[model samples]
Target: MNKQPQGNIFHTPEMFRVFDQTKGHKSTLWAVVDNDNCPLALLLPVHVTLMNGLLRQLTTRAIAYGSILSVPGTAGQTALALLLQTYKREAKGTALFTELRNLSDLGQPQTLLNDNGFAYEGHLNYLINLNRPAEELLQSIGQRTRKKIRKGLRDGFVQMSEATTLAELEHWYEILQKTYSNAQVPLADRSLFMAAFNELYPKGMAKFLLAQVNGVTAACSIELPYKNVIYGWYGGSDRAYSDYLPNEMLIWHILEWGANNGYGIYDFGGAGKPDEEYGVRDFKAKFGGDLVNFGRNVYVHNPSLLKLSKRGYEVYRRFFIR
Candidate 1:
């Protein structure tokens, strides 16, 4: 999979290991291989369940983080179709839906996916080029963002560092929990981060970072760095420190760090659907990256249950997430 140019970190063995070890996450690998056993197409879809018992059934959904990885041309398309058919047959009663979160243009496979019952939706993402001088990169940021970053650094109260210990990871997760809770969005189990720290961190595939204000951690971001790109995974900030702009400072620090460290691009993991009013997308836009509509495709295995699952999720957020 790594040999495929479009293959992403989420499709790699490291991520598969992390997901397999994480609570509420079950990853499955599917591939189409030739007679000689050479792989033609591959996919790693992680089945995510958010709650316990019955609620778990409602929340269960499979996400293919980087979509399908296939060798170039018609042969790859044929393999993908066969794999999709096999997965669909076996995936019944397992989840409400299966979504492919695409990272690149799937020219021919897009039609293949549609024919196979995967409906496409427009999604957006930001990709910032980092193959330039730090000064150039700084100047590329929005005027206001640049000013805030400069002022935040000038204050001398904000500091950034890579998280190393379990205590530090816990602290970072606390900030993320508060942020997600307040937003009423269900976050992945903490075990996911713990697993990433164990499997991906040691190999330099994952980076956990902390931003501090007056020695107290105020913001945190977890990134997956693979090949020449750094994929922003999860992040949050303590609103109490909003005045310090710790989030902005922390992001700029990563951009600058990436520029100097030889990385080629910084991927804002995802913006939201193009038609939606997502504040996160607006915030990422100010970072001066090229917006790309990689979009996503989803196949609903249980349409009736999907509707119920949506309502159930709201209830779950109210009673369980906090």
Candidate 2:
């Protein structure tokens, strides 16, 4: 745990400690403190092994925003520069590259990144303002979205919070697996989800919202509350109940819950690029939120190895893993 005033829950020691315990990802908290030993800036970099440690990469803490927090000024930039240099030196012989993925609207430190030889990776995200009145927020949503929520409610769908039982967790994981399989994408290991649910839910840092239809789980979403923002982390729906539109209902309920609980923002997580025609982005946009850009800042410490590792992973995915 790094000694600092508690601000963002994502930047907290308990969060990283849980990540270390459950996800098997090693995280190091780097900070620049003031004269009084108060942290002026902080960055959490996670170290991960690829291809069984044949290759390594230093990336921002998994499942959280990767922006160095500092007082509103050059302090952040200075700390970022120092952190980059430190990471470079530490990962010289170990990591192929280092990457930082910032939260939306947290603009990239272009000058510093450029000076440090970091490349820009653009992204888009949606943020639903929860400051407005609940009714006003509901009215702001697209008509189709509102209709879906209404239909789900009319159909007797109920929302459940924080699945505590193993059976519930297993059911949610099953839906997640199906969702990924249907999309033709590989599913992330279920352990990560379990770990978060087990560790953060009790502390009120995470919420697992489940939409049920006739006693059966129809849709579920995992949200993380950090500071005043509630992040829509991961979700999946039972395609069999798609007509009921449980997903729409789930999000609406989650938004209502967040608003009622005094959360100022509901982050729809990562959307695709602005120019891209992404269904996920379109779905998220219907809920009425601002689309913002704040993307990845990448630095290649060992370019040749990075390229080689990427190629090797692609080959492995195509021939073995996939």
- Among these predictions, the greatest TM-score belongs to 1
Please report the TM-score between candidate 1 and the true structure: 0.97
Q: What are the runs in model 1 whose C-alpha is more than 4 Å off?
A: none
lDDT of 2 by residue, 1-322 (tens): 2232224556777667655654445666777777888666677766554334323342212222455565446776677678667756776654566666667444445667767776777888888999978888898899988877776677665655557777788888887777776766545567767777767887888887788777788888888887778888789988888877888888998899888989899988889876778999989989999878877777776766666666766665566543
Output the lDDT of residue 145, model 2.
85
lDDT by residue (143-180, candidate 1, tens digit) is 99998888887888899998899998898899999899
**Model 2 lDDT-worst window of ten:** 55-64
> Per-prediction TM-score, please?
0.97, 0.86
Clash count of each predicted structure: 0, 0
